[model samples]
Target: MAIILIADSGSTKAEWCLVEGKKKKTFFTQGLSPYFLTGEQIQNILEEELKQKMKRVMPDEIFFYGTGCANPNNARLVKKAVQKVFTGATVAVDHDLMGAAKALCGREKGIACILGTGSNSCFYNGKKIVKNSPGLGYVLGDEGSGAYLGKKVIQHYLYSTFDADLMDRFDAKFKTSTTEILEAVYKKPLPNRYLANFTVFLAENRGHYMVENIIEDGFNDFFFNHVYKYRESWTLPVNFIGSVAYGFKDVLEEMCHSYELQLGKVMQKPMDGLVKYHTN
Candidate 1:
């Protein structure tokens, strides 16, 4: 029986699935971005995490859909790393956008949006991606994402624009000096993702209007800036995939309704779609 391997890698986590002969297993591992982690680190982490899954089954084909692999150079590096693990196997490396598109649209025509640590969107035409807005990483872009919300939260907090209770809570949780905050924002690697961690606080208290407004603004930014750019005459179905989209589906759906956009579906992860793609 032929074995299949699918990996979805993000800035924070990587999920690996192995399918063979009606038996399947899943594994969780670290991110494997050459831009963020060294080749040796990726090899060590992936080898350790994948060893058990690869013990009795050798995958005939491997599909890697990941965040940092959006760039051609990064995609090549990731492909090389996967090849080292599954030697002689057919390996295809693509940006996480493909996973989102395939998972949401799934060989059907629709708009696929990913709102996680970062945000991105693409228009799919059943067979391929016909249009895509450049994901300007976490900075400058990534509207309707955790990082964007987090940035807004911080901005409001610093400017004394948020509710008093929210400000108090944020100050109590952080309690970090200005220098420390600056260091985290300017001196750290993957600052946007780091900042996105703060959005969890909002998620914890999602009922608060202050938090709600931040999320609303982020989603509105996404719609006005990215999703609405492709103005076709006919209405298009819009689907979403990512942690943020899953966690805040109600809010997203409400926003979509307000904007007169149709919300098609939401997928927490792309693994199910990948399985169907490979097996069926």
Candidate 2:
């Protein structure tokens, strides 16, 4: 029996699945984005967390799909880290967008998007990514993403846009001060992640007009700027894999309707589909 190990990672977490025969074992660890963690740090994470989970079985092949693996340097960094741990396995590292394409589109051509802590998209022709829309990280872009939504939420709160009831609810939920918010956004390491944490508030206040407007505008920007730029946008079924898309699915669906685009699949995570793709 061939043992295949697969990892799907984002900025916040990584889901690892080990497939042996028909049985599968799952494990999790903090994300290992090359933009944030060094190759040594990634190796350390696998050695300390993932290695402990896989007690006995050694895999013949390892596939790692992660956020910053598009760049050759980043891909090399992750590949070296994985190779260091499972010395005997043939390791392959690629961008998370490719994994989303494989998971969502399968063997068909379509548009694949990721709207988690960050956002990215690509045109996939069944086997590989053909054209890509720039993600631009959190500071410049990431429209329709958790981080983007959270930024809007905080901006409203800080700028006194929330009404009395909403203000009270926000305070009750977070109680965060301006000083702390500034520090986290400017001085902290993972500012994008820090911003994305506020999406819980938006989720909780889903029905409010203000909240709905914010979400709608963000999704509109995403479609207008990224998805609409592709020549295949009207012809293809747009698929999404991310937390924000699943959490705010109603708005996502509405946005797709407004834009006259077809929404295909909205998966919170791509691990299950990826397992099938790799195993088969």
Candidate 3:
């Protein structure tokens, strides 16, 4: 029975699972994206939140999967922070993209995708990642992501592109003024995440035709531009691991059918899969 800590993080949330043999306890802390937070800040979060919750029940191994950790430097940054918290424990820090691959595909050959605050896809052949379709962050690309859907919703609202019915519903639901939205997006930190907040409304109103259109267009862009680039996209099983993908599984499956592609697992979070991968 190994004592280990497994984590899955997006730009908005980080989930922690402490496994002592077969018994697992769950904990959640704020998101730790290397793109937004410094190494010292990461350390602070671990110290303040993770340590306090876990107390003295230190794990021998700590596995951290998070956004913006693809870069070697960024991975090292996270490792250093985790090392600070766990002291003698072994730490592994990596990007959420790889997390998606490992969680969805496990030890099987498949294409893995992440469609959370951001988006990414890769071809994994059981043990390693063979091909990658770079997710150009939320600003340039990140198609089919929560941020992307949120962007379209905000665009329609700001430009009055959609009908008054949708606009009125949105306004009534959020009760957010244009100026407030602009301030949160342009002025505050993590505008991508700020924009992703609109996805809650979009998800709630899934039955709306305009919402369906937005979902279809966003997923089409992801499939065509990102997923289709992988050589095994149609040949192997393709799995989705993220909030947006799991939330809109029906729509995502419909898009896959249109491409004559079969879909695989659709996990809302990668923590459980990761725990299984590491423990066994």
Candidate 4:
């Protein structure tokens, strides 16, 4: 059996897939982003969450694709943290955009994008990323990301522009006042994640006219600002691989139709494709 642990992660959470030959089991934990967490902090988190999942089999290799690992220094930070937990395994760390590309296009050239808590895109030519449009994280950019959506939803609530019933429902669901939200967002470790968590609630209430507008607007921004900027990459099929893209696929497709861009597959998670890529 070829034992391997593969993870495709964002800023808020990490999904781990343990593939032992044909059998696979999945687990989840807090994501480790070099931009937010230190190597020791990541090691501590993995020691607690991954320890229980490693009882039966020891992995031969670990492939970790996460946000903020594109730089060699960031990759080394992640590699050190992962090494602390899976001491014996050979670990390979890379950027999440590359993971999206490999998962969405396999060995073919395509434009790959990620719209999760944060967002990213790159031009992939079969084996590696040749060019990438820089993402300004959640605060400045991450246009179609969950955080961007959540920010819009929260603004509507705080501005009192949304329907009264919708505002009431949101209040009942989160029980969060404006003051509370301000505190969480300003004083939080991962404010982007704090904001993005509301995407779950937004998804539930997406049928509302105002919510639909918000979704459409966010997606449009992503396309016009990030994806469309990659002039040459769009000549090939543009594939999306992330939670936000998969969840609001209809809205995303709408943006694509308007932009006249060729929309490819939208996979919710990249672990399965990553597994197939690595194990072959």
- Candidates 3 and 4 compared: the better one by lDDT is 3
Question: TM-score ranking from best to worst?
Answer: 2, 3, 1, 4
Q: Please name the candidate that would achieve the greatest lDDT relative to the true structure.
A: 2
| Candidate 2 residue lDDT tens string, 1-280 | 7799999988678999999989999999999989999989999999999988899689999999998898999999999989998999999999899999999998899999888878889999999999998888899999988889999999999999999898999999998899999999999888988999999988898889998888888888899889999889799999998889889888878888988999999999999889888877
Q: After superposition, how far is residue 260 of candidate 2 from its true place, in Å?
A: 1.4
Give the Cα-based TM-score of candidate 3 against the true structure.
0.93
lDDT of each: 0.83, 0.90, 0.88, 0.87
lDDT of 1 by residue, 1-280 (tens): 7788889888678888888868888988977766788666777787787766567577899989987787888888888877887786899999888888887777778899999888898888877788898778677899989889888877887788987888788888878666787798999877987778878877887888878888888888998888888663038888998888998899878988888888888988898887887677
Best by TM-score: 2
- Candidate 1 Cα outliers beyond 4 Å, as residue runs: 38-41, 232-234
Ranking by lDDT: 2, 3, 4, 1
lDDT of 2 at 239: 93
TM-score of each: 0.92, 0.96, 0.93, 0.89
User: Per-residue CA lDDT of candidate 3, range 114-162, in tens?
Assistant: 8888888999999888889876888899999999999999998999987
Runs off by more than 4 Å, candidate 2:
none
